[model samples]
Target: MKQKENITLSVKNVSKLYGDGCAYCAETDAVLDKNVCPECRTVHACRDVSFDLHSGEILGIVGESGSGKSTLMKMLYFDQEASRGSYHISDYDTSQSNVFGLSSQAKRQIRNEILGMVYQNPVYGLEMDFSSMSNIAEKLIAAGSRNVGEMTGTGDHFLDKVNIPLNRKFDPPINFSGGMQQRVQIAKALSNYPPVLLLDEVTTGLDLSVQADVLELIKEIQREMGISMVVVSHDLAIIRMLCDRTMVMLNGEVIEAGITDQILEDPQHAYTQQLVYSIL
Candidate 1:
């Protein structure tokens, strides 16, 4: 795999606020506390989050629940609108653009052609009643692929790549086990070969054995495809296994970030140290 030196995705000064910015909300830096004003009642889902993802790199954002890691991922994938900031993908242009400024049409194009997302819950990513092949084909159709034969062939290829049985290609995901459903989700996300992939707690809720297998599959895909990925998870073990660099989030703010090994072995932040030790 050829990993480029260029920056792939750049996010700066991103925040997501859920309430009208009252005077208190405007002046107070409540993000570190992830607090809501007693009077204004604002929820800062993500606060001033900034990071650069390099080409062919897997960047992990790790945090406990309500730490805003998922919120940040949602902002990147356009599932939630950021209150402020610039988001730039080098493939789109060298100059940074305010992603929220783009029209709905433009965002849709970006989602279809430039980004792929695998949600934590299979239901969020897969159409349960649809066959495994159709689930993958839907993404291709959205990207303007029309030939049924080509779509089916492409679907089969990815299914095989993810180690899904070819015989089950026509079966609905509802009939599959938890691990198999996730494999189907992975196949669908990669069908278009997008430049960026967003995975949110991808292996959470799986059996330990299944989690290991899925992690190995993810590693294999990264090795083969060289796609840039933002993996959001609370599991430090998973982060250590998959990411080149890591960012530690706490209460809607990034408290620490560095190479994965450094962050895990020599954590400077109290929260990060606690996380690393808990796993040990």
Candidate 2:
């Protein structure tokens, strides 16, 4: 990617393990198949994962199912806790403090004001039966927005930005098609004007045409908003299209990461080579 810009988000030695880890599992050199330790029977969903997100850039985490890419996104969004890790965002606590150590309230504030997330499933990000505008308002309200008129205006602005018709702003998302629902989710996520956005398989399961539209919307949003993004997907094609840099995860570990084009053209790790070649 272009010259390194200011670091917007940084993660260090992040891990998530299930089961009580024994000495064998604790060994840094422990051998595990598919992230499961044979000796201790513990599952390491993510082990010592690390990465950085630069301002105005999109970082993609690509891996197959059970590769722990989604688990990493969950930890960053606080949907799940990291067993061990340090998360620092430039907009939070001067970017020096580890967010994992913060109180629940502080984390909520960070989620509301500093970071926005778009889940692959709109159900997780939207209130299906609530007005689309209400969904956006909910996030604004969580960020301490009290002025109803202003919140509504912000809601309208983002809805329009995402191509959600203003006329349907009061309609429940349940009444919309899948692509439209995803659009609403995108609108709600960006309504906060967050410095960072996390997208987990945002185009998964959409029709090919619809997928292209959503992908275009995302790129346009990043270009116009200048928001840093971390996008997680299992598809190499999606990663190639959307990311400035790419990280390939396997068996709960990042085996390769670098400029998207470089990784695509010249992947170093065997697993990464397989992924790149499969897409070609």
Candidate 2 segments whose C-alpha is farther than 4 A from its true place: 1-5
Residue-level lDDT tens digits of model 1 in 1-280: 2343488888988888888757766664533235465667788777788999998999999999989999988888888889988898876642467666888887877888889999999998999999999999999999889999999999999999999999999999999999999999999999999999999999999999999999999999999999999999999999999999999998788999999999988999999999999999
Q: Write the per-residue lDDT of candidate 2 for residues 53-108, one digit (tens) a residue.
A: 99899999999999999999999999999999899988986578999888899999
Per-model TM-score, in order, reads 0.95, 0.97
Clashes of 1: 0
Candidate 1 has which clashing residue pairs, if any? none
Off by over 4 Å in 1: 1-5, 28-33, 93-95
Which TM-score value belongs to model 2?
0.97
Q: Candidate 2 — worst ten consecutive residues by lDDT sum?
A: 1-10
